[model samples]
Target: MTDNTNNTPDGIQKFSMNYSERELECTVEKEGNILHLHIDNNINADLEIQQDGSLIQTSGPELPPSNIDFIRKHVLGQDAKGSVVATSGE
Candidate 1:
């Protein structure tokens, strides 16, 4: 008898973040001049390439707390991504 084994779930890499009581999971993929952000298998955000090399989000009703330098320092380059979360009014 022969045995075969594989440990790849859905054959995809999972990227996610957790903050406060909110959680977000996404798979990053590059497509032409856009970065696709998917959440739970749905298109949630779109990042566009700017003339100055900066990126901007073109969706959602509000912006999320983020640290671009956090990505730059670790990513080892001038790349950025957007995050979203609910906030309370004071």
Candidate 2:
């Protein structure tokens, strides 16, 4: 019998984070200049790239400003597609 495996799409990746002693597992998808953060199988953040290489949360959960900034710095401008800017629980 044939079985259906994980149905993740192309250009998408999954990873986890350690935030304040909490483990946050999620996926990341890159589209245009935005890195979409998915958590619990749902899109959590649509981080928009700014001119200065910073990212702004256009939608999804209202992440704390510090958490947003932390992720922004981790996102390499030239290799954003390969880089992930994970968030924190708090």
Candidate 3:
């Protein structure tokens, strides 16, 4: 079987954050300028790049404004088929 634990497939990447009580894990896949995000393996969202370079959540989980902003700034701009990126918080 292919090892996907460390090596993510093309057009796919992963990120994570840690908290006192829980952890947040996310997977992002890019198709053109559109990003498909899966958060905590439960929340799924689609972030689209607009003509003005703004990011918008087109579908999926109702995330807080701050969460949306975070995804837009950090997750959406990455090259999905490149490498896996991760983040941690305490």
Query: Best candidate per TM-score, number?
Result: 3
Query: Scored by Cα lDDT, where does model 1 land?
Result: 0.39
Which candidate ranks first by lDDT, i.e. highest? 3
Report the poorest 10 consecutive residues by lDDT, candidate 2: 1-10
**Model 2 Cα lDDT, one tens digit per residue, 6-90:** 1122256655655445666757676656767776665377776655455667778666665555444443323332222434432
TM-score of each: 0.47, 0.56, 0.60
In what order do the candidates fall by lDDT, top score first?
3, 2, 1
- Lowest lDDT block of 10, candidate 1: 1-10
- lDDT, candidate 3, 1-90, per-residue tens: 322222322387777754224679878887766778887877777766554445566777555555655555565443322222222211
Query: Which pairs clash in the backbone of model 2?
Result: none
Query: Which candidate do you rate higher for TM-score, 2 or 3?
Result: 3
Each prediction's whole-model lDDT (CA): 0.39, 0.53, 0.57
